[model samples]
Target: MSSNRVTPTEAWQATASRAADCALFFDFDGVLSPITDDPEASQPVPEVLEALDALSRLVRRVAIVSARPVDFLRARFGTLSEVDLFGLYGLERSHGKGETVTEPAALPWVPVVEEVASEARTALGDKAYVEFKRLSVALHWRKTPEHAAEIESWAHAEAERRGLKVQLGRKVIELKPPVDRDKGFVISEAVLSVGCAWYFGDDVSDIKAFDALRARTAVEPGFLGVCVAVASSDETGQEVSDAADFTIESPVAVGTFLADAVKILQANAAS
Candidate 1:
């Protein structure tokens, strides 16, 4: 583990000290699951799921915040009822087996998003993989790196014409409704009553959540927020690590870290 602030052991100890008042937030891809060219094939490591399950019992709340849809997340995390799933960057959220609650402002844009997805597929013509989520669409150029710029340009133009919002990711550009929802907003609201929180992520978009933690720690006395970055190679990875309070190597490392966390939290509770 690498950190500029408190050491990893200290961070774990702080979280353990307030286990019941601390919530943990995680980004699915590159944090729990390894990033894959085929998004559907991405699945969290089995041990990581186990670690999260153990951590869930010790924390106030544990949530997986991702750019993917709720259904996808649920399919993998269905067995872990204590873990909340926030999908589409907080456009939709489901607590355990509960019904998914979508942001009210984004409802009307479903049809518009559908139209954009159709247009994107037709225009891109397999040069890019177009993923059509109900409230958003993502154009992925991971398989065809040559069309990266073109796909990004098309996505931006579509977002502008449709009055949607554009979110950039690794080899992907997503267009969602113009609603004011994101990981930062989600974390800020969830941690309102909590004493401490930690957010783990690997992508640049996760920076917003890190900033939210900083914002909370700045104003809220005695509140502790730790930002953990899952290390990567690209520019986005570098930016994320720079904003993080600490860095871990990969999803596998995340699994080990969470397991270690569970041990400390359990020990602290027993003491």
Candidate 2:
């Protein structure tokens, strides 16, 4: 095991020598874009997009696993034809060519999420706000810190009533159907089907991917996996950093990391 923390530049240089054995994955919202007051309007940092485009040529597979709807992420970075997009924590998948493949069972969960969001809004009142993501719904209390406890209670109770699962993220609580899917599960499946994997993320939800990477390595010797946590000053960011194998300062750092990886891969291919 490597104990020294490598910067994005160093990490890429190391991987360039073993390009064929690596796969890169990222969490979209916080990893690629700065968290915004309005989740619906979040966009990736300019450098992040450019880096992803460059990295696409280096590794065998580069993907994004996120809680956002597939279409939403596709709209943001779909212009690049070399990256794969996985949304809803792997419940949905979109290819680089703009084609999407989704789990059939996940489709029906949409209306259930809508109903839950409506009920949550009425129950929580103005103390909390609701974000209706296409596949999931989030109740945010960042602006109303006092309502965190109340929001959590309501989310748990409401999710139970609807037979759905509630995920705690940052200062928000999300409701999604209890699917046999998660970021970790997705990463494992991707690795088995594609060789080795790397994941970058910035939230507690991403811990599932980190755990998955550890588990896979334990069972299979010589498996190449990299778990990265993008850092911020928030509690959620701290949690993710603790769970990750390495930490990067911000989204720009992530972009620089990806771009460097691409360069290494290209140089190796030419050599």
Candidate 3:
């Protein structure tokens, strides 16, 4: 927890007090799903999903903004139609089971992204796991931590050559189209009309979202922006914790925290 630490109940009460005008945003990995070596195998804790199901109805809106593609997020959250999905760091969006909409600017880069992924797979080989998203490519060195520096250097060089954007994460580097879109851009736009908003995230990339909230709070009178970091042993977790308003232990704690938030919101409504 940072100096801004507030009890879970206090945090919930503040947001629940303005539930009608409040919006909630979350990052899928680490915050909702446990981090795993195999990215494809990660699954969100059912308890968290259960809580989100309730939270969506209580709040003005609920959304998951992630680096994964909207198709991937939709597969995981298809039933939660009330929850909006923003994937590929805001390049994609799906509103409440609606069509997955891609930013027009990014559509032209699909071929380039595919080419990059192919080149990365051949160049990196068994040294890294190359993930191919339609609009981006991510190289993961988690299993072979010793190759982190090598992977990072190669990713940066690739980005420079291809005019792509490089996103660094926990033992991973992603190359995407050079569009000026990111987690911060997503949050800043989403909260424009919101009176109170809370964003939960767990990686270094998530820091942008926290920064977005702080920036908004600074300029918007009577607006509340809560940043909750999910703690882990990884250095990114520490960085996120430092930037966050408070810290929750892990994805398990996130489930409990959301459940508790639901209870507080209900009680406040009844009162």
Candidate 1 lDDT over 1-271, as tens digits, reads 1275589889999778889999999999889988888989999988899999999999999999999999999999999999999999999999988899998999999999999989988999989999999999999998999999999998888888889999998989999998999998999898888999999998889999999999988898689899999974353457898899888888898899999999999999999
Q: Lowest lDDT 10-mer window, candidate 1?
A: 231-240
Model 3, 1-271: lDDT tens per residue? 2345577677777787799999999999899988898999988899989999999989999999999999999899988989999999999999868999999999999999999999988998989999999999999998999999999999999899999999999889999998999999999999998999999998989989999988888898688888988874465456788888888888988998899888999888889
Q: Residue 155: error of model 1 in Å?
A: 1.0
Report lDDT per candidate.
Answer: 0.90, 0.81, 0.90
Q: Residue 171 deviation, candidate 2, in Å?
A: 0.6
Candidate structures ordered by TM-score, highest first: 1, 3, 2
Clashing pairs in 1: none
Estimate the TM-score for candidate 2.
0.92
For candidate 2, the 10 contiguous residues with the lowest summed lDDT are 1-10
Question: How well does candidate 3 score on lDDT at residue 128?
Answer: 95
Clash-forming residue pairs, model 2? none
Clashes per prediction?
0, 0, 0
